[model samples]
Target: MAMDFSNAALPAHYGLHFTPTFHSKIPPNIDPTSTTLPNPFIVVVTGAGKGLGYHISLAYASAGCSGLAISSRTSSDLDALASEISKIAEKRGTKIEVLKVVADVQSDSDVSNLEKEVRQKWGRVDVMIANAGVISKYVEAPSSSGSNLPRGIVQDADWARVLDINLNGVWRVSKAFVPLLSESKDGPQALISSCSMAAHSTISELTPIAYNVSKVAGMRLMECVANDHGEEGVQAFALHPGAVVTPQTKNHAGGQWSDILADDEGLAGAFCVWLTKEKREWLSGRYVSCNWNVKELEAKKDEIVKGNLLKYRMVV
Candidate 1:
């Protein structure tokens, strides 16, 4: 059935109501069967050279999946990560492949080359993670920054750079890989989105306007992709990885370790373990936090899906 959520109300904490049809009704902590884990799947992660991307790629590699790590400006870091994964895979006697590629997601030609390379190496890709992004600095121009910028204030090239990498880059990668994902006979492919809690909360102290806006747009992008391809087995999810200690967060904010541990560390770990579990079909197109609150969020799935579809039309 077509999912619809035209009249649902958002939770009080989010300040907006978004209810939808086609709820999963799955328990938050329910575990998937062993056969459902995406092992031996070929996965690709952008910005996988460092930070959260590095750790996430490692997690997948440790789980016995072949991973391709890409970066725009950090070939050395990407190489190191690939090498480390190779070592771990060899020690475990599990056949996991790690390929490191240097391509700027903002450049159409670069991303095109990346697609070509992956296709040549692997016939099909089962998973993709669009995780590359940036933040704003305080040393550039006002007009070049964004529409909300105030007069006489220098916003810096970093502002536009962030949007280019966070938004346009994602578009480039997803567009290039959709065909490959659709070719999979097992079913549609999966996309893991690195979204943020800032999108739902107004904690100005915790988030800057530019970062929040980009992340919100990112989550909606995943929803739209899911709506378009879910019928064919291509599913996407927007995930808030919580406060993992990454260079991106540390560059703009502080308290990396403390922020992550403030919540349940085991819960987050369990969620990661669940990510690769089989029966992931039950979790497709959902926005997941630390704990697998799929059922609670299902009530709003329809509205979220519709809003994302509308936003996609505007962009196109």
Candidate 2:
């Protein structure tokens, strides 16, 4: 069996091996509005209509990113997000060119259209966050009667739909954006995918098999990207964006799991900005959690590298 990266299978002292220190909000050091990124930096974020995606775009805009490309299937959501970003830019007295595109990750042509728009507008991409994802419909939740409902197994179509969006969708974005990342000259060319702690879960009652398997596979896929593109100065990472309450999770388990979602929604966005603020190649191809304390993580860099922790492997 694979020795997964879950808490039970790893050392406790390592922050990532256990539940990280809960950060309910963006810290001062990583606050985008306070800490500005370099000029001419352009970023592309998929699924930017709401939830984590919305916050991430806001964080980038607040940080004063020069160019921002946000894609969502819903045009109205994109319009609203663009307006909010404009307000942020005005408040900060920074000019951020916001590109709102209606594109679905599930469609090859739509993703291609997103890429074309970015290439035409800026001709390069400094950071790409493949954040588009979905949860399975067949979940274990509390029925109105207050009794634990039976966990329904995900159907074949439901399983395929999850993988198509969560795993294959990431692949589509990577294929369409890596060339632009290579063209970037003044920014950190980083590719970050939103993986999850659920990637390590085996309990079907807690997470659907499709979501679980897709995340696991997506983590490995990012590893492959790092290995394949590191020489090109393109750093890649798979990230667990912390346990925040999103539209997807607000009613998860019929609010039975609300307590776990108390984490700050903006934590992941700040973390992403920090991750790509500079090139720390040591962390490429690894799995990182947004909730991990940055100071502690920095202190443990040598040990982490020497031991080659924060990766997927099989233990004897």
Candidate 3:
């Protein structure tokens, strides 16, 4: 599928009364100073061992966040990332505490234990980035093969594995952490998402049904959290961090797609940093790409709600 980065069309639901002029003055990268604003905020980043998670952790560190808890399946990778961030903080003359936890996001016990540790260390958490995800072979393939499993033909084991970490895992972590975030005087919970172009476009051949379903499920989770907790000062956002050239994508790409993935990594990383900034609240519960805020997509809010209801029904 061809990717278009231009900002030309706006969905009618955005309630955009006027066509805003595109400005070249928008900073190409996130200003580190914006992250250091008052109120020491504690952040927890899942899947922080590599890829977008690694960069997101650094963004928080640059902002002088109080402390960060990094979690991934591999302890060594998490420790290495924490060590690098520690050095960066030291050079900046800021104290950013780093905690490494090895946990499989798929397991309830793991999520529970990680939450307990964080609550013990810091009574409150300001940000929770539910970023851990796995793209199984079904979703990672370049195209569907004749012998390939049916679309959405997720095996019992694959279903368990994907939903466990992608959907249920996020729920477990979010539910566990909400109490801590609620304790905070100021509340902001950001849930990071990958590109949801599949949700918007019919690319079943290029994208797997399971992966699309998982991401769409993820977006709804954020919305439900926002609706339930917004009045309490907790705001939730679902962010599409663009395409980043990561090890996972590298293993999935076949031909030209490989080059596209490689080129998008840095741009995507920069965009994720910018999206985490304070100004992104405007794009809450909506799909975003290439720094383009798809607030118009918010019109389908009811559909998102319905999708969540159906998913819960199936799970229950």
Q: Tell me each candidate's TM-score.
A: 0.72, 0.90, 0.75
Residue-wise lDDT of candidate 1 within 1-316, one digit each (tens)?
Answer: 1112121322333322222222122234533212133554777888777666776676566556654545545889887887888886786677776666888888999888878887888878777777787655533332322222222213333456767888888888889887888786473387777776546643332444566667788878877787797777777777766555456644332223243323332233234445534435555666666433545455555655566321323323
**How displaced is residue 312 in candidate 1, in Å?**
13
Per-candidate Cα lDDT values, in order, are: 0.60, 0.82, 0.61
Query: Which window of ten consecutive residues has the lowest lDDT sum in model 3?
Result: 17-26
lDDT of 2: 0.82
Error of 1 at 235 (Å): 0.4
- Clashing residue pairs, backbone N/CA/C < 3 A, model 3: none
Residue 231, candidate 2: alpha-carbon lDDT: 83
The segments of candidate 3 whose C-alpha lies over 4 angstroms from its true place after superposition are 1-29, 33-35, 138-157, 187-195, 262-282, 293-316
Arrange candidates by TM-score, descending.
2, 3, 1
lDDT of 2 at 30: 79
Query: In candidate 2, which residue ranges exceed 4 Å CA deviation?
Result: 1-21, 139-157, 254-256
Candidate achieving higher TM-score, 1 or 2:
2
* Candidate 2 backbone clash number: 0
lDDT of candidate 1 vs native? 0.60
RMSD of 1: 8.4
